[model samples]
Target: METVLHTDKLTKTFGRLCAVNRLDLEVNRGQVFGMLGPNGSGKTTTLGMLMGVTNPTSGSFTWFGERATHLTRKKIGAVLEHPIFYPYLSGQKNLELNALIKGADPANIEKVLETVELSDRKQDKYKTYSLGMKQRLAIASALVGDPVILILDEPTNGLDPMGIAEIREIIKRIAADGKTIILASHLLDEVQKVCTHFAILRKGSLVHTGPVEEVGKGEEVVEVIAYHDDLPHILHEFRGSLSVKSENGKFLVRLRDDFHSVDLNKFLFEKGIVASHIVTQKKSLEKQFLEILQETTSHRQPT
Candidate 1:
């Protein structure tokens, strides 16, 4: 895949405070890439740097394997914070004005509006649109330019569940069309659902980066239950168990990355123990995110 964006040792400082630290990243073509972090974690600042709204204090970055300039920026459609449109104007008119300003083809208006499912409301005044409709219109403006990449900051923030879901589906559709997307959001679930790759930031630093699937492919935790008398012996005999604790009449066993629940059951069966119940708990992205934060926090503390 072609590299759409690349950064090397990117750093931003506000006097004594570092808003973004020595960050390095590469976003490939056709990737739905996510930048995830809590508030004040520099997610927005990083996007700002990429968009050229904020200058980097140090280091450098490139878009499409070349230096980012006004012309290069035109190839990227972006929405930061919120979409802007005239309240008195219709949705189609709003897009037309945007298309004119962006030098985008006027013909793109109809297609982009339909892409966001706002074609029916194209003649309706922007003021009459719902918050979700307003957001989708904002995305429509971005699409008018037919950019190679999309950069969004908190695309679903401050919206109800239905609104969030609507925006998410639109984004998924855009990614399906092979447009590279780089989105910065604090919503872990949104990233897990939409992004193929993600980078977790903590206090202006890059803490973790990988494919989304890898986040859930960590060590397995098996919940097992055997006869009351056999439980203690099974726990004591399990060599692959990392930690074992009793919870709700079952043994919650944390196992090494290579271990599985079936392995535990096999081990017990060989020893003449029959487990009444056993289940493998699939790790969620939220859990993995918290664990990464905790690990980074611990590593940053003084010895």
Candidate 2:
């Protein structure tokens, strides 16, 4: 599979501080590649360089297999941070302005408006539009040229629940149509739902980069919630790696990889401990995200 975007030892510095360290990234065609990190982790800076807004202090990158040349910018559409629109112009007019700048077809205005579900409010002035609507319009601007790659930074910020849901669905549909996506977000749940691959950055440095499922790595952790006080004691004896979490008057024991649900049930029954709940947490993107976050946090000293 051909990579739509590739970076090799890309670095950026702002005077005394390094905003983006020597980072290597590869985003293949039709894959939703997620960049996950805390604030000021160089997510924005990396995107800026990739989108040609920021200059790299050193290193190299390629888009669509060619070097990061001026012509490659035409094949990509991007929305970075909060979108700024002309408050006085109608949504249609704003998209028209961008479409014209991109040298895209005027006929695409209606198509993209419909794609972002903004056809009904196309005539509404930008100031009258909701935050979600503005985002939709921003995304519509990206879709107008029908570019192969879409790069978005924190696309769901300030959106109400419904608006977030709408954007999530739209992104999935775009991916289904085979457009490559480079998404940078702090919204772990959103990333988990939409991303096929992920690269986690910490303090401008890349920590973990692989398939989304790789982060979901580890043993199948089964959680046994018990009401008895002795359950924790009994659990400690049989576990290789256990996480004992207490909540709602019960102890939640995360069983080790070698333990089976049936084995735990049998042990609990024989030991005379009442099992309140036996829930298994499936290997999920959320679980993986949190593990990575915790690991990163541990390495940093409290100031």
Candidate 3:
């Protein structure tokens, strides 16, 4: 895959506060990449630096293997929080104004509007449109320049479920068209659904980065119940067991990364124990995310 964006030790600070730590990241072309983190994890600050709106205190980034320049901004479209559109003007008019500012050909405006499904309401005044429609318009404005990459920060923020679904569909469609996307969102489920690749940040530092499909490939969790009175003690002593908890009269056992239910079953059988109930399930992205955060927290704790 071609490298679309690369950052080497990218750092940003405001006085004593390090908004973004030394971050190294790479995004491949045509991949829908997600930046996942809590609100204060420096996601916005990092995007600001990448988009040229904020300067990095130290570090460097490149676009398409070349140092980012003013021209690079033309090839990338972005929409941040609380976008401003002319309320009194029609949706079409607002886009036309935006296109003028972007130096994009006016001919592309209609295409972008249609792409965002706003053509039917093109003549409607911006103020009259619902919140979802406004967000779609903001996206259309970004698409007007025919940018190869689109950066969206909380694109579905403050919207109803239906609005979120609409924006999600639009993003999928855009990604299907082979455009690289950098989605900065605190919504884990949304990122899991929309992005092929992801990076997790905590306290302005990168904690995890990988393909979304590989999120829970390692580690296994199983719910089990045994007739033996010593089930809890046996579970704790199991070599493969990482943690065990009792929930709803069943023990939820988390195994080591390289261990599975088979290993646990074998060990139990050796001890002359047979489980009355056993159910195995792969760890979910949400679980993996929480575990990652927990591990980072533990590492940071004072000894």
Candidate 4:
């Protein structure tokens, strides 16, 4: 795959804080990459640097296989944490300015507005639009120039469920057209649904990066909900092959490194206890994220 964006040893420091540590990233042409981390994990700062708004303390990045320059930046589009627009201008008017500034065809104004499903409200004053609507307009501006790469930082931050779904669909359609996209969000479910690959960061450093599904793959996990008083003794049946995660009335079981869910379930069933419920689940991006974050809790430096 062709790399549309690449970074090497990227770092950013402010006074005594390291907002972003030595990080390397790669986004292939047409791939939708996700960045998963909590607030202050440098996701926003990283995007700011990638968009040329902030200077990196020590590192290098390239767009379109060449060092990022004002000229090459034309191929990128972005919607940072909050969208910016002229409150007094109409939605269409704001987009018109963005279109012209990017040197895009004036007719692209309506095309992008429609893509973001904001065409019906194009004439409304920016200040009159709801927060979610304003975000849609911001995305419209980014899409006007038809950039090959789109970078969004918490694009769905303030949206309700329906609004979130709307934006997610729009992004998927963009990627379907073969444009590369990079989404930075705290919503693990959203990332699981939209991205092909993801990287998880903790304390300004990356802890995991791989195909989305693979990142969530680890030892098998099962949730057992049984109304039994002697659950602890029942758990002993799984001792040699199952690592007991919790013994609460409802239990979470981690299959021994070498055991599979099927084998474990069969064992539980043979032990004469009614397994009220058994759900096989992957390790989950959230689980992996928290686990890694715990590892770095003591090492976390103010950033």
Candidate with best lDDT: 3
Candidate 1 per-residue lDDT, tens place, 1-303, comes to 799999999999999999999999999999999999999999888888998999999999999999998888778898887877899999999999988877899999999998889999999999999888888998999889999999888888888999999899999999999999998899999999999999999989999999998876868888888875767666767888989888988889999878888889899898888888899987878999999999999888957
lDDT of 4 by residue, 53-172 (tens): 999999999888898887676677888889999999999899888877788898988888889889898988999999899888888888988898888888899899999999999989
lDDT of 2: 0.84
Candidate 3: how large is its RMSD? 3.8
Q: Model 1, clash count?
A: 0
TM-score of each: 0.88, 0.85, 0.82, 0.85
Clash list (residue pairs), candidate 2 = none
Taking the tens digit of each residue's C-alpha lDDT, what string does model 3 give over 134-247? 889989988999999999999999999998999999999999999999999999999999999999999899999999999768778989899988899999999999999999
Predictions: Cα RMSD each: 2.5, 3.3, 3.8, 3.3
* Candidate 1 clashing pairs, residues 3+ apart or interchain: none
Q: What Cα-based lDDT does every candidate model obtain?
A: 0.90, 0.84, 0.91, 0.84
Tens-digit lDDT string for candidate 2 (170-198): 99999999999999998878888899999
lDDT of 4 at 262: 69
Best-to-worst order by lDDT is 3, 1, 2, 4
